[model samples]
Target: MQDCHILITRPEPENTLSCERIVTHGWTAVPLPMLDIAPIEDAQQRAAIRSQIFDIDTFQYVIFVSKNAARLAADWLDTCWPMLPVGVHWIGIGQGTTQALLEAGIPAISNPGHTTEALLEWLKPAKMKDQKILIIRGLGGRPELGDKLEERGAKVHYLSLYERKKPHYTAQTFFMLPDIHLIWVTSGEGLHHLSEYATQHKPEWKTLPILTPSSRVNQQAKEMGWIHASCADGADDNSLIKATEFHIGKQHD
Candidate 1:
């Protein structure tokens, strides 16, 4: 295990944590952040976010799509709302997001699973007619959540608090790809970037095992001609570590 190297492609702060966890498990962790998270700093957008934070109680449900969404929304809510209003349900899409919300003092936050589809299934049985749901996330994501909520007779609002941009990698970065034993792609965008980089600069590395957090990314990797693409149960750190270990064990077998 100590001889194994796992390439982590998550963004900073998160990448640091993931790398530390891998090291704790007696594996070498190499960080190459594929996406950079930037906050929305436009005056108009900030004003709109402030308005939503002030009127947080109006929405019956507040949904956080990722850990980034939970952290950014919690920052605004902590600033604008002296105290979180009671009776409003908080929904986190996964364990990581749920833990972030809980740490922000949001009580009783619910997380159905790691994927949006799972969350939708868990929410389908709830009464949504005339209910208002606010979704906080990065800019330009899937519309399925809002669309499904609308179909259930719920009004949906979005607070695009951050943007995810592909990071510029130098030639040295791609040179290290051939040495990486395993790659971990947490998001679809990360997988796309990795595929693009590998195709352009390190095509031989495409055969290396890739562990993803979702089926969507796994499919994308396979379509890109990656021979070994495996998916974990969720995006949480524990799931990712287990998946990485399993893939490494299989490689030895």
Candidate 2:
């Protein structure tokens, strides 16, 4: 993997972690961000958030869906909660999100694994029944987690903190492909966004090897004509690194 160039599709700021890990493998990390997180500006959504600012304590559990969600929740908490509240359980969907909460000085936090399914399994219906839960997430994500929680008799609420947007490229992004050896797709949305960008501009870039965080994303890459693709068994940094190492090892072997 020495001198290998790895491209990261996650948005800026948050993409730093993946970049750092790739560099640790002695690979050049290229950040061609596929998505940028922006706050939702809808007047109705903003007004609703403002109105419910005080009701934050009513929820028994606050779930941070991603590291971005944790950062947003930390910002909102600075204005609303100020000091950390007791008795409210904070659940981070993955290790990255859990670490984000820890960095924010949030003491009581739990993360089952790195995916929604793991989190849902950790939250058994018997334990969650009748409990009030607030899910802090970005603009668009799967509703399965929320739907399942509600079906189990929990009252679920969503506080969408941001939206993922495509970045405007200055030069042709396709020209940057030759130097890229491996690419990490953090989410299916990021993969789709990158695919859309290539479709309109640089169809040649689709041949690069891509590492996905989930099977759904890996399938999306296959449909997009990616010649080489791999999916991490789990979404944590360790699993992602393991997947990348395995692929690179296989290539050299």
Candidate 3:
């Protein structure tokens, strides 16, 4: 594991923490954020998000799609609902998001798994008929979660708090490409951008093992010609580290 280098595609701040964790396990972690997250700058959009938070109790479930969503939404929530809304269940899509919610003083948060599909599975057994669900996420992403919730007889709304864009990579960033033995893509967008960039700049690096938190990402990676792509148990740092170690062990065996 010491000789293996893992490329982390999570955005900054988060990537720093991931690197520290990977270093503790004796594996070199490379920070190569494929997507950058920025708070929504438009005043209209900010007002819209605040409006949703003002009427937060109207929805039965408030689902945060990722850690960024949870953290960003909580920032607004702190101002709007100091007392916390009643009868509204909070749902974090994964462990990291769940932790963010807990840290924000949101109690009894329901976290199904790392992926949206897992949340759907957990919600399938519930009585969601006519229930309102508010999904907090970035500017644009897959509509699968909202679509599935609507299909289950729930009215779904969105509060887009942040926007994700492709990061600009410099020439020096490409220098680390050769040493990246394993790639950690945390989102579908990250995987797409990383694959597209590598296809144009570092095609040979695509053969390296890629570990993702969801089957959806793994499938997309395979479709993009990343045959070594694998799915970890979840999207947290520990899951990624364990997956990387397991893959390295397999190479030795």
Candidate 4:
């Protein structure tokens, strides 16, 4: 069988990681970075971020929403605090986020599952009625986590550590992949960005089989006119690769 050409739409570092794993299966992995994540570089904004990092002890619990959040928040903390704040509990939402925290020398706790909803469910045992919670993430993300915590009587504060920008790709982007067999998207936002890039050039993309990291994104893909989107259950390389092999085999059969 010929190697399947699969497009990986994650940001770099992560994109590279996923591609490395995908190629081990003898599939051609294409690196098409959808989001560019970078720390907030504005002088005033930098100062504000540093202040929030330094004062994390004020919050009862601090949550890192993504690997980028944990990494950038740790970078800011490395500048000021010789020692991490003692009483502030560090939490990460997913395995990748937890691993990033651990790599940055921050001790963090993670639940079995990934997602804001899972984190909230795991934190049910931890009383937060009168406590302050801090959530660290990229700029302009969903307010669901904070809003849910607020509903439970916790005062939630957000520390914007970085920004996730969609990389500009011409409509000709999709045309360049002449032999592309499949596309894997980890998030709804990535699917949206990819769709926008394909708009002017391809107009319709319902025939191509798409692999999504989760059912939520799978539904989003279907809602946006994708007729053959399959959920891989998770974004890690194993899940995506397994789903790809299965879907490709099913197509041939």
Candidate 5:
């Protein structure tokens, strides 16, 4: 555990949290963000999301699909509403998203299961008919959550707040071998970029352990020829820490 350097590929703030936790364990945290988060550059789209945020009080419920959405949406909400509108329910897909909401002064319902199916299952008890539900997310994701809600006769709206883009970098931008003991990426896109960066730095280092947030990402890592692809099962801090410790221990063993 001593002197271990974990390569964190998540974006700012989130990666910063990982760094704080890792250093406490006497491990070095190396942040090399692969994806950059930003507001939608299209003026019309940006205006639409902002308009929705302004009219947030009209919605019966607001569901944030990811931490990025929760963070961005919270900022907009903070600016738009001095006092959060009552009678509006807030929900987050995972503990991380819920934590982000809480940090932004929004008390959101959270669950251990971070997937869309899990969210749908949890909402089974509620009567979704005639409910105005707003979904906050980044660009280009599975439509399952929105689709299911709409199918249940709930009016679903998407307030895509940001875009996850790759950061252009040079070979000199990364630390390899001795400095990076393991790689941890929450998204498959991050894992893909990690592979490219690692290969560019030192192709042989692909043998190093890489942890993913889900089984889908683990499978993708394996397909990309990663030998030590490990799934963390969840995206929350505790899940990530436990998975990191388990994988790092397994590697040492």
Candidate 6:
């Protein structure tokens, strides 16, 4: 069987697991990271964490918006609180985030699908009126969740634990991409990173086929002149693999 290659543009955890799943299903995975998430640059954020560590008990719910957020928050929790606070519920924004928290020893977690809308839907059942919710997330994310929580009478505290910045596309990311048969883009930001790189350095991608995770990303790809483009349902590895298989199979047929 001829090996197939698929490009991954998501951050870690998702990137890592997506590679594992695609390879397990007998495909070659190429990771050209579009974003690098690191700790928030603000010193005051760290200082606030230190100052509020002991008050973990005051929060009725602690929500992690991504695996990156979950990992950073868990590390900070170990250094700050050290012990798990009683009656504090944990909410993970996606399946991957929930698994990350569970692996980190947080047993009580509410995991919705990977969007603010899904998180809100999951929270609807809990009906946490007047509860204090602390959201540990990355910098400059969508504020819809927090705003809705506040509107629903929940006291919301949003903390930025990390920041997502575009990673430099090394020669490896560009030179090695020609052999890649498929590209799996999870978000518009990830696609924007690729488009920006192509615009500055490699103009060949204007003709390339792209497999995006949503119609939004597909539209973005089309706007960027990617004539051959398709969309998966989401960033989930399974969904990505299915998309790849469908495209590859169609080409073969």
**C-alpha lDDT score of every prediction, in listed order:** 0.86, 0.80, 0.86, 0.83, 0.83, 0.78
Return the TM-score for candidate 1, rounded to 2 decimals: 0.95
lDDT (10s digit) by residue, model 4, range 1-253 = 3488888999878999889988888888889988888778899998888888778889999998888888778878888887898988899987788988999999999987766777778877449787899989889988999998888889999999888888977757666865677888887788888877756566555567888876778888888878888888776666777888898788779
lDDT of 5 by residue, 30-121 (tens): 88788899878798987887798889989988999889999888888888898999999999998889988998899798765866777788
Error of 2 at 167 (Å): 1.8
TM-score preference between candidates 5 and 6, better one: 5
Q: Note the clash tally of each candidate.
A: 0, 0, 0, 0, 0, 0
Clashing pairs in 6: none
On lDDT, the stronger of 4 and 6 is 4
Runs in model 2 deviating more than 4 A are 41-44, 176-178
TM-score of 2: 0.90
Which residue pairs clash in candidate 2?
none
TM-score-wise, the better of 1 and 2 is 1
Q: Per-residue lDDT tens digits of candidate 1, residues 134-212? A: 9989999889889998998999999899999989987887775537788888988888887888788888778888888
Write down the RMSD of candidate 4 (Cα, Å): 2.0
lDDT of 6 by residue, 12-46 (tens): 75787788888888888887788888886668778
Cα RMSD to native, each candidate?
Answer: 1.5, 2.1, 1.4, 2.0, 2.3, 2.8
TM-score, candidate number 6? 0.84
lDDT of 2 by residue, 79-121 (tens): 7877877778888988888988999887646645677877888
Overlapping backbone residue pairs in candidate 4 total 0
Candidate 6 residue 135 C-alpha distance from true site, Å: 1.3
